[model samples]
Every structure is written in C-alpha cells, then in structure tokens.
Target: MNVYFHTFGCKANQYDTEVVRQAFADRGAVVVDDPARADLAVVNSCTVTHTSEAKLRTFVRRLARGGQGLETVVMGCAAALDDGTIVALPSVRAVVGGADPGAVLRAAGLPAEASLPFPLSATRSGGQGVRSRGWLKIQDGCDEHCTFCATTIARGANRSRPVAEIVAEARLLAAHHAELVLTGVHIGTYGRDRTSHDTRRTTLGELLEALVRAVPAVRFRLSSIEATEVDDPIARLLIEAPRHLAAHLHAPLQSGSDRVLHRMGRHWYTAATYRKRIEWLAERLPILGLGADLITGFPAETEADHRATVELVRALPFTYLHVFPFSVRPDAPAARLRDQLPPAPIRDRAAELRELGEAKATAYRAARRGARADGVVSGRQGGKVEVLTEDYLSVYLPTAGWDLRPRFEVTVD
Candidate 1:
C-alpha cells in the first residue's frame, strides 16, 4: 500500500511527521510523493489559529471529494479537539490525537510493530542527509498558560528527552542536514522535567553547550523561544559560538502594550524588558536577524495600544515580523473576554503590520550588500545556488556543475 502525508504547524510537527512516515515505511508501505497517487492520505493538522483550522478543513474536504477515493486520516492538535467534531466529518476516516505514530499505522491497516529507534540512516538521503534541513525534536508540550493560546490545551504539560538521546541523533544528522533546527513546543522549558545528575536544574543554554561540543560541525538554530527565556548566558553563547549556534533569534513579543500583555496572561516580563534584552543582543551581535510575533486587534486593544505596538516595532532593528490577526477560539480564555474585534479592523491592522514588516526586511537585506557570509546551499536554480545564510537571509549565488555543494562560503553582493 502507498501512503501520502501532508504536515502542518511547527517544526516539532515536521519532526513528528518524519517519525510517522518511518512507521509506514517499516511496515512495507511505500510513502508516495503525491496524495493523489496514494491509497491513504494523512493530514498532520494544525489548530493553532482559526485560519489554520479552516485551511485544514478545506484541504481535507477537497482531498476526499476529488474522486481519488482517498482514505483520509487526521492527526495533531486539530484532531484532539472533542474528537467528535473532526471525526464526525464525512471525509475523515480516522483521527489520532497528538503525535502517536502507532495510531496512524493501525488506521492504515498496517502492522503496529514496535518502531525501531529512528535509524541514524533515516537522516541520510542519496548518500547525503536530509539534503536541505533537519528538524530534531528535543522536547514536547507547553507549561505556559497564555490566555489566547489553544495549543497549551491540546499539547498539555512539558516533557524533555534525555540529553544522551538527542546527542546521538545529532551526531548522525550533523553529517547530513546542512542546517539543523532544534525544535519543541516550548524549547526554552527544556529540562524542566529532569533535575541535574547532581540535582541542579539544567538550562537550555547548558543543553546547547553540550550539543555544540558533541557536534562541532553542525549549524544549530532554535525554532521559537519566549523573550523571557533568553538570559545572560544564552546571549553569550549566541554571540560567541558562530559555527555551532546560528546568529538568528525569533522571540515572540505577542503584544507591545503592557495592558494587553497582562490580559494575555504573559506576566514574566513587560514590553520594555523584552526590548532591553533584544537591544542588548543587537548591540553585541549587530545585523542579527531579529524577528517577533505581533497580534493585532486583541481584545480591548485601543488605538493607543496599536500605536504603542507600531512605535516599539519601528524603534527596534527588526528584520521581519509575523503579523497575526487575533482569532477567537471558543475554548480559549481570550474568547470569553470583553470587546471582541470585528473582522474588518483586525484584517486592516494585520495588513498594516505586514507592510511595516516588509519595509524592515528590505532594509535588512539592503544593509547586507557586499558583505561576506557562510550559508548552506538549499538548492540549485538555473545558474544560481539558493543559500540560506547563517543570519537567516535567503540569497542567490551564481554557480554551476560539480562545484556546487550543499554548504557554501560566499559573499552577498
């Protein structure tokens, strides 16, 4: 039997998909490249936002009704919601909550044999590795209770993998994936479940230091971290370790107004505190790819609140912004709060924020003109190699034939 898979949501989900894919392959099922050609189609769903949920529902409907007679299975956070909702859908044949590979296999009528530890060979493709990038999940779930987040409800409490296990995987992946992103639902909360071998709490920085030493040749990047999690030592590591840790930070400043932040139940720090930390990092690592998440039209967010957000973003040297229009999920605390925003104004504000983000990105690219940098070549297009720079800039380099390699030392001109 042939199986086709489509993934949604975070890098953690991407890593989980790889795990699920391996289970099918081990059961003598061919994992096909196209959903249309497969006997079964599995959608690794996302329920992080209303838009994401709507997209998945639409895609599943289309996939089932396309006359391919596709047996559809849904997984991830979307499938975890009240089961009856997604499971009741006529298009969906089966549903698995969270990241359980066995459920997926059983749904496909494949043998539910014990999946061997992900083979070091899994990272290898065509005698190389992942070829582009590898996502390794080191932790899972969230402990934070952000009022607007539905993910925490679906994913549950935090749990971390042992350091030894992660290191072993990294050792093999280091040779294949030019860039390895260390991912989790809440990466910064890693090691919160485990006390030290000596009883001290292990920090995220400590994990990185170990990973750096274990795989000196690997280029590692964190997926997304809270602003409060980046303490002094973590900042030092980012500045000092060029070959190991990438010089890019994606910290979500969900809102720039303190009142909204309070309403959102993110009390670890204020907007000024977040800005100070960003500024401190920027001072040390100039040209750092500083990006953040912004939620426009949050509950009771006034014109002044919006302006505060705009001002904070403008003052900072941000390379990009993930502008999201607030959408209410009925289960979330924010959904029940007062003064819900209309769809039109939320869209307008989101658009404005995106335009501002584009301007920042353009300026960032322009500033890097004629600068020399090292990047991992993702693909070859025509006479140019597409390289993702250490600082996360996507640029094209002129090259051809045998000289084109996966990783490159080139100049941005």
Candidate 2:
C-alpha cells in the first residue's frame, strides 16, 4: 500500500509519527510523500486547542476529497480526545487513541510483528538519509492536572525510559544526525516514577551526564521543561561542558500573576521563583537562548492580571515567546469556569505579546552578528541549508548539499 503520513502537533507527536511510519514501511507498505499518490493517509494529530482540532478536521476533509480515493486514519492525541465528532466523520477509516505506539496497525486490522524492525536504524527520508535532528522521546504523559490542560488526560501519567535504552538509541541516531533533541511531555520529571518504584533510579540530570559520555560527538538540546526543574546540576552543564549541552533552555511561564497561576493549576513555581531560576540560568549562560510560553486571557483574567503578565515579560530576558491566547478545551476546568474572555480581546492581547516576542527574537539574532556557532547542518532551504547553532539559532548558508557532515561550523552574522 502506498501511504502518506500527515503529522500535526509538537515534537513529541512528530517523533511518534516517525516511529509509526517506520513500522508501516517494515511491513512492505510503500511510504509516499504526496497524499495524491497514496492509498492510505494517516494523520498523527494534536488537539491542544479548539483551533488545532478545526485544522485537523479541515485537513482530513481535504485528504478524503483529494481524488486519490485514499483511506484516512487519525492517530495520537487528537484521536485520544475520543471525540465522537472526529470518529463519526465519514472520511475517517480508523482512529487510534492514546500513546500506544502501535495503535494505528491495530486500528487498521494489520499484523504488527516484532521481527520487522524499522528498515533503517538512522533517520531516513525517501529511503535515503536526510539532514535532520534526531529526537529522543525519553518520556511521555503528564502528572500535572492544570485547569486549562487536556494533554494530561490524553497522555496519562508519566513513565520514563531507562537511561541505558536512551543511550543506545542516541548512539544509533548519532550515526546519521550530529545533534539529537531530548524531548518529552514533561522531561524535567524524568526519573520520578522509576525512583518511586526503585531506589537505584537516575534523574534527568544523571541521564544527561550518561548521554554526553556515551555519544561524545553529538550535541543535545532539551525540549520545554518546567522552570523549577532548572536545578544547579542542569545549570552547571553550561559552565562545565558547553559543547555537549546546548545553551538554550525553554521554560514555560503560563502566567505571571500568582493568583492566575494558582487558578490555572500550576504548582511547580511562583512568578518570583520562575524569575529567580531563569535569572540564575542567564547569569551562567549569558547568550542562553531563552524562551517561554504565555497565555494572555484566561477565565477571570482582569486588566491587572494581564498587566502583571506583560510586565513580567518585559522583566524577563526572553529571546522568544510562544504566546497562546487562552484556549478553553472541553472537559478542562478552565472551560467550565466563569468569565471566559471573548475572542476579540483574547486575540488583541495575544497580538501584543507576539509583537514583544518578535522584537526580542530580532534582538537575539542581531546579538550573534559575528559569533561562531557550531552544529551539523540540520535542514536544507531553497538555496541555503539550515545549520542550527548551539544556542538554537537557525543559521542559513548560501551553499550546501543535503547531507552535510557533523561539525559544519557557520559564522552567524
């Protein structure tokens, strides 16, 4: 069968899609890039917000009418929402819910055997190697039941992978890509579950030490982690071994007002705590690529609340922001809560934060006017291929092929 995999959502979802695609390929299914040339089109989706869900529905609808007579299937978190509207759609052939890696094959009534491993050990594109960063989803699921979140319900509780297994996978991925991004829904909480079950368990800090040692050549970037998780051990990596660990830390600050944060079910850190932690990180890693996620309008979010949030943004040394207009997902406590802001003001507030983000990003990029940043070329553009810096800047060069070697340093100006 000719299959085209359509993936939507976060890096974790992207990693999951690659795993699923490889599984299908091992079973003699020809993976095609174009939907029009495929017999099956599987959408590995995300439904973090109502708009995201709408985008998926529209995308699925378009695929069904693509003139290829393709069978459509939904996988990952969107399907896990278990929304009747998604499954009842006449266009959908199958729906696979939750984080079961092999949920698609089971939904398709196909055999999922262990012998047929992913054809290539390295990350492959169109049956050949491509410039890409390897993603290691070392953990999944969330334990926090934030009032505005539906992800925890979809993904279940935290279950971390063993350190040895992670190292093994990183070694294999290092053969193809020079850099690997360690990702998870909640990576900071890495060995919490295992440590509870067994005393001799390793934390995220210990795992990082092992990974850097195991694969000396490969640089690792961390996905989003809670502000509270940025302990002394993690901060020490910037000063000790700058080459192994990237100088970037994506910590989320959902709200600046402690009241708003509490109402949102955020427990890890207060506004002051978040500020202190990032300040410490910045002091250690001066050019540290700092980023945060912000929600503009939430239930009962007054003008004072919004002002406090904006003021906090101004105070922080953030290089980029993932500003989300407060989106209320069904079954979330925030959705049921009173005083939901209208779409207009929410959009206006989001726009303000976004402008601030753009300015910060431009400033951050400008600061690296003549700095030398190193990493393997991770992607190819029209004429210039992209080489991601140690601090997570995507630098483009005028000339390069798809398969650029590791240690391809570029002067970012």
Best by TM-score: 2
Whole-model lDDT, candidate 1? 0.81
Candidate 2 local Cα displacement, residue 205, angstroms: 0.6
The window of 10 residues in a row where model 2 has the poorest summed lDDT is 114-123
Query: Compared with the true structure, what per-residue lDDT tens digits does model 2 show for residues 373-400?
Result: 7756776657887778887788777654
lDDT of 1 by residue, 73-159 (tens): 888888877447777665688898887788888877776755545552346443222266687888888888998898888888898
Instruction: Assess the local accuracy of residue 353 in candidate 1 as a C-alpha lDDT between 0 and 100.
Output: 89
- Tell me the whole-model lDDT of each prediction, alpha carbons only: 0.81, 0.81
**C-alpha RMSD by candidate, in order:** 2.3, 2.2
Worst ten-residue run, lDDT, model 1? 120-129
In Å, residue 122's CA in model 1 sits off its true spot by 5.0
